[model samples]
Target: MRIISFQLPVVLSDLDGNRKRFLKAMAEHADDKDVIFMLPEMWGCGFDYKNLQNFAEHTYELISEIQSIINSDTLVITTHPETNQNKVFNTVYAVTKTAVIGKYRKNFLFSPTGEDNYFDKGDDICVVDFKGVRVGFLLCYEIRFPEMFRLTASAGADVVAIPAVWPEAKKDHWQTLTKARAVENQMYVIGCNCSVMHTKKKDMDCGYSVAYDPWGSNLYESVSGEHVLTCEINRENVNDIRQKIPSLSDAMKVFEIKRR
Candidate 1:
């Protein structure tokens, strides 16, 4: 399957602008099938917490528009502000042309940025099957939590997509964690991060979109810039790596930890 990550600039609170850029990118790859396209976290509005409700109001419209542009076999993954019961959540959506195949809200909020205050956390861990591939999700801050990823791996996830707005300051952490997730989980890890934002914040959105195979090999890595990174992966690799290492299967399903 072909996995593509859309790394582009996000203008804070500019729903229309971000939507246009997202659609333009989607249009370019509209005809492709058996492909998964991942977008940066909150691609619609970049943490415009003050106007989050307004952004949430347009979430459905933006999704519908994207649905119209993609092919039936194409699956698009991204996070946006979604309102439920008057509470806004950072929701991850896996959408096909016909319907929304999978959905998961951000479980781990970034408290450093006060994300916990603005967004309601989700309780479920989502792992959905798309064209025979078990695709899992991890929003920005959630990547730091290995337990969540281990759960996804144990649940039979072949690929995990991380949508983030990671900063340039911690680029090394981004690189290390992304590879580690793929290595430990024995699955493909695709990270799609936003590039140069139109914000006053110095260099927050450092777009280094990347993909790694189950063997922790870099399939494709983009420099610090706005560019769509694509890599073709074979599902067989996951099986092969698991058979070779047998780490996932050898792991103890249940264990007791006592203070030493």
Candidate 2:
């Protein structure tokens, strides 16, 4: 399967402008099918905590517009602040042309950004099957947790998509963790981050969006700029690596022992 990770400038609190940029990016790959397109966290609102309520209210409309641009066979992954039952959550949605395939609320909200106080935590992990491949979704801060990746991998995920708005200062962590997750789980890892530099604060996202294969090989990596990186991933490589290493299988036994 082919994966396309988009590193776009996310303008804060400018829903209309962000939507336009997103549409423009989608236009470039409108004809592609059977691919996965991943975008950054809080893409529609640019991680604007103050206006999260307003953006969350219009989340459905934004998603509807994005869904319209997707090909029937292409799966698009993006994150937004969603309003559910009068509470708000940082959530990732996996959508195809027709409907939303899966939704994963970010369980690990960054305390440094005060996200934990503003958003409700998700209690469950989610994975969805696209065609014959099983795909999992994780939001920005969730990438720091190996247990979450383990759960997704244990659930049979072939590729894990991490949509982030990671700061430029932590670029090394972003690169290291992305490869580590892929190597540890023997699955493809796609990490897409925003390219926009924050105007209101000292924050600037490092747009080193990257993809790592099962063997910890760098399939593709973008520079610190806006880019659309497309690369093909083979599931056979994942299967072959797992068969040879059997690390996950061995870990399962240790987990069982600890549980007992």
Candidate 3:
């Protein structure tokens, strides 16, 4: 199946503006929902980490305007300010046209700007059975942690997706880690990043949206620009790779991790 790893250069705090951009991108790839359509992290607010709570989409009803436009079975991944009990969170929501399947709170929130100031960290990893593909999710910075990747791989994930708002200064880190995750896990790894100028921070958002096959081959990727990297993920390839090396079997003995 094909998957569109969408990259955006979002404008912070401009909900209507960003929605327009998202809809435009979706319109371009509307016919391809037979595959999976994913988006960058905090897509609604670019790198608007500080303004998270200010324009939070406290209810799914509030964003029904956008949700209504999306077709059924489209896996559109994006972040919003979520309310769980009295506490607020910077959470990524996975939405289909009819219902919400699941979400992952940012586990490794970047704090150099005190991301903790606006968002709370999520403790659990979310794995979903999507479109005959076992998909795993992690927000931007979480990809740097090997344990997170291993945890997902252990759960029998064939594909892992990371939605990020990576900065230009650390662009190399973004590319290197993305390829490494695919190579080590032997699963398709997709890294979607923001490609806009940050009004709050000095650095520009890097737009190296990429996809790697189970063999860590760069199937598709772009430089620092706004683009969508679409590629077909063959399940047979994922099965063949795992069957050949059996990294999962090797890892089970060498490293023990609690499975959910």
Top candidate, metric lDDT: 1
9 Cα displacement, candidate 1 (Å)? 0.4
Misplaced by over 4 Å in model 2 are 257-260
Rank the candidate models, highest lDDT first: 1, 2, 3
Q: TM-score of predicted model 1?
A: 0.95
**TM-score for every candidate vs. truth?**
0.95, 0.95, 0.91
Q: What is the alpha-carbon RMSD of candidate 2 to the true structure? A: 1.9
Positional deviation of residue 233's Cα in model 1 after best superposition, in angstroms = 1.4
TM-score of 2: 0.95
Ranking by TM-score: 2, 1, 3
Who is ahead in lDDT, 1 or 2? 1
Clashes of each: 0, 0, 0
The better candidate by TM-score, 2 or 3, is 2
Pairs of residues clashing in candidate 2:
none
lDDT (10s digit) by residue, model 3, range 148-182: 98888888788888888788788788778888988
Candidate 2 — worst ten consecutive residues by lDDT sum?
251-260
Clashing pairs in 1: none
119-185 in candidate 1: lDDT tens per residue? 9988878889998999999887787988888877877799999999988778888988889999988
User: lDDT (CA) for every model shown?
Assistant: 0.86, 0.86, 0.76
Tens-place lDDT digits, model 2, residues 106-207? 888899979888898888778999988899988877878988899999888999999998887888888899889999999999998889756576657678
